[model samples]
Target: MSTLEQTPIGAPGGAAPAGVIHDIGYQRYTGPRLSRRHVVGALYGHSLRTAFGLGRSAKAKIFPWFIVGVVVVVAAALVAIRAQIGQVVLGYAQFADTMSWLVIFFVAVVAPELVSRDLGSGVLPLYFSRPLRIADYPLAKFAALATAVFLLLGAPQVVMFLGGAFTTDAGWSGVWNEFTDLLPGLGYALLWAVVFGGIGLVVAAITGKRAFAAGGIVAVFLMTTPIVGVLSVLPSTTANQLAGLAAPSSLVQGTGIWLFRDALVTNQEGGMGIGDFGPVYALVTVGLIAGCTAVLLARYRKAARQ
Candidate 1:
């Protein structure tokens, strides 16, 4: 046979050889691959959508209103105190101080809703069935809320610093001075947010009722702080500064500001150095935050495995 005639039948152009072709039926799937960016984007997009929807609705809008109200009240209070006392009020010194409260509020109130709403509406299961992973849920939620909290809490600090700088004796140089003065303050803000945010997430994960989570967060972070503060004064080692359940008191104490004064007037140096019990207090703060993270991860793993 000629070379052309001897070619196999199963070639692309034609089939000449008998029994050369075998049909193996398999459906080809040409869908796009899901990636981390896609997942993160979905999460971020959902968060923005959720926030927007809340704004459009009456009941949901309450949260934002509450935030605004808090800011307004705080601003007014600061002004009044400055006018009356010739110094800023306790707990109303800088934007960072006020923003700390906002972070605490967000954790206590908004966090439960983030997860509980989906769980209540039976949306969580559906999320798990898709390319969405359980781990991403907490991460996304934290990131979204953290970003908002930072903007809500941190941005004001920047503005306040700027305003205080140029409008007063604190120009750019003064701004830098205040910024340096507030480095510890910034760290305290982050420590507070992460610590409480993690607590809120863990509580939401553990409970079926969002109310329970919310209430628990309040009792643990808000009410417990004072209670622990009282206990810490009872002649115990943990009572001195470390006795409190959360980091706020220690942070405040470490910051050397008492009862929310603006002058940084405490006899203590605000523990700016790690050797100055700053490290010890920081380690405690980090430990609490780490615990919350562990709890969140463990809860997510359990849910995912189920």
Candidate 2:
């Protein structure tokens, strides 16, 4: 009041007066910054944990573990049958094909959890603000989802292998054969992981709403099946031969028939009619994985910019 009374300030047409400044004593962080690789590794680990709901709420744990339980229970029953009856109802390669629906459901449920929430909460910008490049985030998510799928499919195959090995009358020779078969089975599971993970992540990354993302993923897999049936019934032999390309499940089955005919097909009559276009199936399968991956990268690129 004394200063104001002593001098009148800011009359009309007068210039503005400067305000006082004060230092709050905040320190600058000059510490060593972690590189991009560390950021990516951490993100991958976090995403992988998210896939199985490791640190998530109990409600979040239910669906993934339910799918896992069903798959395991089925595998255990098959192992029991192999031990007791000495007859393999389904071979190693067939196990993946048999579990295709469950794999789809798992991907539908988990992929959205991995990505959509980040999108919904608008945390991607914060993620990009770190040492991570645009590509690192999407690739980390893709790798985590793929590893999770592999574990889901691979664990039960191990159980089946152990059951077969321990129960075989052929002794060590049987164990070796079981080992050999398990390798192809795991490889087939890897293929499943790639196809589903790539496709699912790309779809999930497109939207911020988890429900929409999940529905779109389900539709992507399920809606294509009828097209395959229609193509299979077509009059053209070429259409029938290439019909499996229409759906992801049939596409993987066709690829399996091409690569692991002995494990997937019991007879010429029982197998997919991929015909001489086996190479086509192989090429298309690779294309699906590669194409989905490219799209995933592009998706995040656009997201990062915005």
Candidate 3:
């Protein structure tokens, strides 16, 4: 019947009773805060895991691991064949050409999952609210993706090298020679990682929808190939050679040929004479990667400002 008792539920025209405050111990974080570098590193590691669908659901993992399994199996088969028949069935450098489509599919699937999910979920503000800078986000994401692509491309080559080493009847010298050959292919894979990863991230960042982003990335890569093909058949060899610049795959293959000093039969057989372009393709490849990276940075910068 006192004042406290008078504050009953649905007490008409009565002021609300004062709320009770419980003293549960809640401590402020006085621990050493991580710097921007650590934040970027953490993000990079996470994005790399995300690329292969690690730490994600089974459905998410199937695509990447499936591609990886296929590559491994093929590399193993090549090695077995070499051991049996005593000849190289697939060269380290040729692996890139053979697996180009799988690489494209991978970048398309992963790039969207990296950037578009962040944008679509409205998490950029949360990311920006941390010690992370605008540029750091893209840098980390690109690094993660590039690293992922490199592993995707490089792991098979390593397997191929080992396969070649053990299978070669020439012994230690053969192993050394195989190692030397892999070096250039490794370099070529690095180029693929950079160029493909950069462009995929840029395209994916443009759309919040993962499907749309994936589709756009695929379309851009696949569409350019046909255009290059058509142009390759032109009467003028110069025009045909120049057309290789239009497609990223051609450009990378062209650069690989120049760097490895080995003619890529795919480029030659496909009528896209990218090797003829020489260092021009390498220069263009670097330019394209640089340009895409610039655009990706600018896009994230704008998002951060907003």
| Top lDDT prediction, candidate number | 2
Query: What ranges in model 3 sit over 4 Å off?
Result: 1-19, 263-271
Clashes of each: 8, 0, 0
RMSD of 1: 9.2
Q: Per-residue lDDT for 12-31 in model 1, tens only?
A: 66655533334466568889
CA lDDT, every prediction?
0.58, 0.87, 0.84
Q: How far is candidate 3 from the true structure (C-alpha RMSD, Å)?
A: 4.7
- Put down candidate 2 lDDT per residue, 3-65, tens digits, no spaces: 222223654455453443445566799999889999999999999999898998999899999
Residue 96 error for model 3, in Å? 0.7
Arranged by lDDT with the best first, the candidates are 2, 3, 1
Of models 2 and 3, which has the larger lDDT?
2
Give the better candidate number (1 or 3) by lDDT.
3
Model 2 clashing residue pairs (backbone): none
Model 1 misplaced stretches (Cα beyond 4 Å): 1-34, 48-56, 76-103, 181-184, 236-238, 245-276
lDDT of 1: 0.58
lDDT of 1 at 73: 60
Q: Which RMSD does model 2 reach against the true structure?
A: 5.3
